[model samples]
Target: MSRRVLITGGASGLGLALANAFLGRGDQVLIGDLAETRPDSLPDGADYISLDVRSQQDWDAALAHVRETWGALDVLVNNAGVATGGRIDVEAISDWERVLDINLLGVVRGCQTFTPLLKEQRSGHIVNTASLAGLVHGPGMSSYNAAKAGVVALSETLGFELAPWDIHVSVICPAFFRTNLHESLQGKDIAMEATAVKLITKAQMTADEVAATVLKGIDGHKRVILTDRLGRQAYWTKRLVRPAYNHFATKAGAKLARKTRDA
Candidate 1:
């Protein structure tokens, strides 16, 4: 059976890769993004819809489109989010608001909007693309970390809340990977942005690799999917060895502070 899937922010980056992956699996995919028109970069077999996660009107339109086109959705991927970074004191409140609106509440809106349909059908899956920063916050990313952490927390809550309806919820926490995620980054420090870019560029995994792992995780109904070895190790370290994790976090923070100072 070809499942109907909708992915937000599917115009580029990991979203695009996931769209391609689902298309390869013979799943019918509809990409919802902020793009005014369909981008040529979209996968050949997938469909596109103009969607802005921050807008209620857009979300409502998406739900209508899904109902009219697919009848019922099998999967909803709340993958729309912006990259953000800044020190606690230096970060602008507006940046935090924007990041949280898109990263955390965006998923919330999607789940809220789609849950009714899924509950009515009594089966569905929701995948949220978070980040390793959500699990293991290092430094210089207060806004980003808070937003992603909120996503992790929200996903967990939904896992239990939606279980009665047999609606599976999974949160993807991937470490730095080679994607255009850095392009949406917002911050006051150029050095921090550069460092983020370096980490993203130097990562060994590609969006396709991460997307493959995500699909496997969703198949297994994993609650929290860590897409890379580094992400897993970091998560476990923060979980089982708090002292060591704190030490590393402080050290990393100091290093980042020094770099920002020097820059």
Candidate 2:
């Protein structure tokens, strides 16, 4: 059966990749983004809508447009998010607020607005894009980690609640992937220390690969999707050696602090 899919932040990155993946599978894909220009090379039949996931009005308008076109929604992918990089103490409060508003509350708003439509349909899936940082704290990106962690927790809770209604929820926790994230770093009030920058530069995965994993998780009704081998290892290690992981994080933080002080 062909699924009607709506993806927030679908103009680029993992969201765009997922849109293409679903479109290739013959699903009716609708992409919602704040971008003024749609991607030049989207799938032939894909639909694009302007949306700000943080706004309920935008969600309503997008859902209305989708219903008018597709009649019903089978999947909602809350993929719109922002990233911030800096120590917890040094980052501005506004940075924390902004990241949470988009990364965490955006999912909340999407669910609140679109869930009723899914319930009316009696079957659907909700995929929230979290991060590996949600699973384990890193030296920098405190705001991003907090927002993503909240997303993970929110998705898990919704999974249980929505089970009775046959609405599956899955959270994607990808470590890192090659995307326009660096370009999107503007207006964020956080800057990574040198050591923290080195740590983030080591991840190896592409947005398409991560999107493939996301689709697999959706098909399998997985509770969580880890995009790569390293992500899986980190997830298990975080579970098995949580105290040790905390100690390691502390040590890394100390090292980063030293570097910052020296600079």
Top lDDT hit: 1
Query: lDDT at 153 for candidate 2?
Result: 100
The whole-model lDDT of each prediction reads 0.92, 0.84
Can you write out model 2's per-residue Cα lDDT over 1-263, one digit (the tens) per residue? Answer: 89999999888788889999999899999999996567675667889888998788898998899788888889999999876767666777887888889999999999888888888888899999999989977876788888999999999999999888899999999987777655555433333733334444545778888888889899999999888887887788779988877788789888777866633
Best by TM-score: 1
Q: For model 2, name the residue pairs that clash.
A: none
Native-to-model Cα distance after best TM-score fit, residue 12 in candidate 2, in Å = 0.7
Q: Model 2: which ten-residue window has the lowest total lDDT?
A: 187-196
lDDT of 2: 0.84
